[model samples]
Target: MLLLINVLLASWFYTAHGQGKPCDYPVIKHGWLYYSYRGYFPAHVNQQFVYSCDRYFVPPSQRSWDHLTCTAQGWSPEEPCLRQCIFNYLENGHNPHREEKYLQGETVRVRCYEGYSLQNDQNTMTCTESGWSPPPRCTLVKTCSKSEIRIENGFLSESAFTYPLNKQTEYKCKPGYVTADGKTSGLITCLQDGWSAQPVCIKSCDRPVFEKARVKSDDTWFRLNDRLDYECLDGYETREGRTTDSIVCGQDGWSNKAACYERECSIPQMDTYLNAYPRKDTFKVGDVLKFSCSQGRIMVGADSVQCYHFGWSPKLPTCKVGKVKACAPPPQLLNGKGKEIHKEEYAHNEVVEYVCNPRFLMKGSHKIQCVDGRWTALPVCIEEERTCGNIPDLDHGDIKPSVPPYHHGDSVEFSCREAFTMIGPRFITCISGEWTQPPQCIATDELKKCKGSTLFPPVGKPAHMIEYDHNTNKSYRCRGKSEHKHSICINGEWDPKVDCKEEAQIQTCPPPPQIPNAQDMTTTVKYQDGGKNINSM
Candidate 1:
């Protein structure tokens, strides 16, 4: 009964002095005890720690003091109060294997799961007097390399070199191309290594090919409406021309009808205004085809083609739009504009009128037209009025159909004296009011010094053309003449002298001369009208 009273009194004493902190329960903070204890303030001693060498720690080799005793001290040697941490609680995403326990000075290695790592990343948990050191958390710092990201037929939206975990981007096809299924592929997701899947685009059709034909495009792949231009192989030809040799691509693959044939020319299917006259279905060797354009169009290629053994001499002709006015795009005069102001087009034989700006004068032809698919007399707007200079005289000659007061581009023909040869151009043209080099009446070479001769043709004879050179001699044969005719060249002139008689007829004189003759009578020389003969009979 006295012991119970004493126990109650002691409890009251400890509560009053310790502020409710039980001595046996030593205020362990962020720490665990190494052993069990006993205490009641002013009575029994308290074990400050819980310690066991079983699976967590190795016991000390020697001890100098006993434990669990109280003598003017709080507890007995809580020193040597080593804690055990054989196994640890999981912190999630970290790996801890092999080691079942940890002792003082021993390390506890741990690793985070793939794609995850600890904040400190020291990868170790250590046991100490205080207990296992504060553990690290498993965090994410994922990164992906740009080189690892490969997308086919498409590109990534982000051009960055690296991406964090969960980063996303898009892929798109190039121009004039599309993806299969006619829908955009799902967005790309960054995985542990790289992007999820590569993308590809497929077109409706591929480029077309022919047996003996070729396309001029640099690429071999094509899509809808992509024209596949081609030409026939050498020694071969299509039914018509180059235009007809092409096929188009569609949803139904290639729409080509170009076929190569041997040695034949057919009329091509041409646009409106283009004509190849009398075009039969086909033309054989030696047949000719004439190509022309309508009133408002012009020929863009050969005027005609002939069918040879190797097909058409030329591929074929094309008639293009010929809105050719004096100037299709009227000249930009400094201060003038056309009455009918169309920027680029004009029809054949179309006329254009122009008015000069105020204070400016008009030069050249006022009215211009599209003549035969070409411009004629394009006028201009000038700031000043213009005139031409004087006409220079021609040496030893007079102008024929002379144009006095010669203006720009005015011209005149030149005539030489009776026996004179013309030198230089026969016509003198004026340019910018100045005449071109005037022609001269060149003096003739005097044949009087060289002398001359005449070859007399005999009756029933023919003359043969002969060639002559200066100071040279040549001979000719006449049909009825008994002898060859000889000629000499002097001063760029040829003189021939020959006397012939029929070999079958006698040469005897019967009052030799202009006698009564048969139908084939002939004479070597004749006197001028009303002129007496040098010698009379």
Candidate 2:
């Protein structure tokens, strides 16, 4: 019987193996050996083998398996069996029934549809023997939040609205109105299907109204809308408001035509002066008048007077009686030609005499008297003529006599003695019988004029390089770039060399080329740096 059983077993093993089928078997050899349809097994069934067999097994009676048997079953293992199955499938290019399998602590990725983003985790959980836990789910993400809208002095249809992600709000201003900040087309932010903040609508001003200068002249007056128009009375002009028919009325008051009146003053007249005559028909506030005395008469007070609000400026000045008087008497006298006496006062016709010591001579008159309450003449004392006649002449000198003998009223002049130049006065006068000090002369060589050199060259278009005289002005121009240049002397100082090619040449150019509107050209270049660097280009 054992022999017959061995033959049958052997035949069955060969047949099953040839069919590429999998099966399970009972333990063998008194628990020391075991066998399956295709292979030998141990007493204890290996869980891994059992899983594999279960995945590919068919009912034992339904035999007739072929090389494609495993694929035809469409059976795939779970967990441990699937891991090996997957390996087999990869190695042999076989298709497995199990779509996917995750081990413990493993994750599977998940994705959302178009137009949507995952709000929850986008990955899956692993399957344990306890069964697959719920996989991570994906949710759409929202980009915008609800927002509020506000209008100045008004209300909004809705204060808030939920906006989809990446969306915006369009704004419009009310009729008869404009935007204060943003225009009618304004926008608000939408974050995660919500708005960041409320959008605002602001109020604006209307057409401006002009106020006459009398009403808005003061700076304090201004329109509520931050705009104002200004106008002035007839005969006045506007100084500011131009466009927009409005002005900002600065601290200096209304800018446009401001009211004002013409200023005027009444004419003035003159007052009289003491002891003076008027030279004109009338006088004004500042007129000046003069005063004087008749010939043989003298003035005693101010000679001029002015007209003022309070009549003449310094009160009318006066002119009084006049006379010529002699100086007070000297200390001493000699020869006693006449007795000396002191008088309280002298009348019109009073006479007095004077004399000098023996060797000295005097100048001026010897006797004087009063006439018309004034001194008739000046009196002086002197020595006799005999003393002056005896004076001797020095070497290199000569004694020249007067054409008319020297008398009390006569004067004489003297010149240098030959080569010797006299060093004192050259004229002398006779007074009271004696001649005054002799005259002196000076050398002629000391009277010549000074000689100096001219600073500028006399030829070659004499460019007054510079002149010491402050009043002299000069301009220079070169013929060409090689030598000619344009230059000017400012306040007696010459400018550094300038290129002539860029400037007008002297005589060769017709009066500086008749610069058309030169002044306007100056204005154009005034703020410009000038084309000095043109050559670099």
Candidate 3:
């Protein structure tokens, strides 16, 4: 029983030891973890246990652990102790093995040095159970140094300059010269040594010239900057100044000279109608004279003639015959006013008659006889008298009697007062103490009113068709449309609206008959009483 107990205790101790937890490995700065394990363990253990140094154990198969029985009993055969121990270790930070040191297979990064860019990969190898792969390398950056410096006016040679480090040069222009643009003091910049390029200089012109001409000297011949004197020619005059004159050749042209000669007039002439007769005396070349015509006859040519240098004058005048007889062509008769027994030639005791146009009255004798080759006295015709007794009251206008009694052959005019028109003649003749046609008083208001068929005829529109009130001088548009109805009525005669349709269908009526040629006539035909009696064969 004692031996069995002891064996049991030993087995238990082995099992417990095999079940021991993995030991934690300390991670060195810039380091990694690595691991290893056994291939087999005791059969009673079935499987080998495995663990990472920093984390918990993984499955045995993953860690290279397996199941295998111990060959000799009593004490387990230490066949390399069934499983070897595993751990982590530190390495050169740049070594590839350092990647395995990390249990999580984490990565580690490297960077370039200051003032340098990375030429290789930006990041180094990652960290694993082994250690960091390899640290990245850093390189040095390139730089330029200062060269030469240059300068230019109103311009720059190159945009920028490179220098070794810190250095400069002073800028300038030559003596007696100035900069065209930019700073006169010059410019400066830092180069390793001095400036890059150089500066330049420029030049300018001189003052202007003055000149003048003398009266004796030809102005066209004078040169620039020349001084001269002046004098007038014979018979010519100069303004004030002896040497007071001066001129210059300006942007415009030459200047300065003397005034030239001018002629004046002496004795002049008197203007008249007859041929000009100049005074018979010695006179200067430009002198002028004039003349006139004698009485009884009028001058036929230019009213006044003048004397010229060549001879007598520009024009000649002559008298023309004057009229002798007092009477001229026989005067036109007024009303029944004047008569001439005969025209051009008149004989004694020839009788003549004077008659006025219809409606006018004669105020003197209607007949005159010639005496001593001339008609007797002239006669006059006047307006005839119109008596209101015979006058009719027209609808559109009115007439009032004159204050003075009308004479036998006198007449008076009638008219519409306002807003009215006289439909008939305003004047009426007096016949046996009564008016031939009476003057009428009428209304203007009713004249504008129309009350007929609204349909206008296929003829031209009417000028007027108004009804007139005789009592009030009022007029209104007229009523009804008739073929004979006048569009307007004036002087008691109707002016009817004309139908244009007839005009469209017909050519104008043939012109009035012309006298038949005697050669063409067979016999004469007499036309009378609207019928013709044919006498021709």
Poorest lDDT segment (10 consecutive residues) of candidate 3:
518-527
Return the candidate ranking by TM-score, descending: 1, 2, 3
User: Model 2: residues >4 Å from true position, as ranges?
Assistant: 1-117, 120-162, 165-187, 191-198, 205-224, 227-457, 460-537
TM-scores, in order shown? 0.24, 0.22, 0.18
lDDT of 3 by residue, 336-416 (tens): 434443556434334566677555655433444443334544445555554334445555565566654544545667777
User: Per-residue alpha-carbon lDDT of model 1 for 1-537, expressed as tens digits?
Assistant: 765676678768666776442344443322334443333334443423343333333444222222343333554444433455655355566434544756566676676665555554456777785566645456666767668756555666667876656767666765445565554444666776566656665443444446666556776566667676677765466766442366776656667564665556566566577787775998865566776788766654345566654445444545666343333655555577778776586665456666666445555434455544555444455553333466567677776765456654456788887777665678876554456888666666642223223353333433343333345676656666555777666455455443344446432211112212212211212223342211111
Report RMSD for candidate 1.
Answer: 27.6
Best by lDDT: 1
User: What pairs collide in candidate 1?
Assistant: 33-50, 34-49, 34-50, 34-51, 35-49, 35-50, 35-51, 86-100, 86-101
Tens-place lDDT per residue, model 2, 1-537, is 765576567557646666433333432211111123433321121222231123333222222221111221222221222111111122112223456544434444444443343334223334433333442333455655333445553333334454546666655555433344535445666675356556554444333334334434344324234445444433223333222234443333334433332211122232222334555555654455656565545443234555543334332323345664433433234543534647656543355555554444544334444434444333234444542343234344455675654555455556665445554455665655566776434343332222111323345443433233322333343443243333443232334333333544331100001123322111001011221101000
Q: Pairing residues by index, what is the TM-score of model 3?
A: 0.18
Which ranges in model 1 have alpha carbons more than 4 Å from their true place? 1-94, 100-200, 239-244, 257-259, 263-537
Q: Count the backbone clashes (under 3 Å) in each candidate.
A: 9, 20, 61
Model 3 residue runs over 4 Å out of place are 1-336, 339-353, 356-401, 445-537
Can you give the lDDT of residue 433 in candidate 2? 57
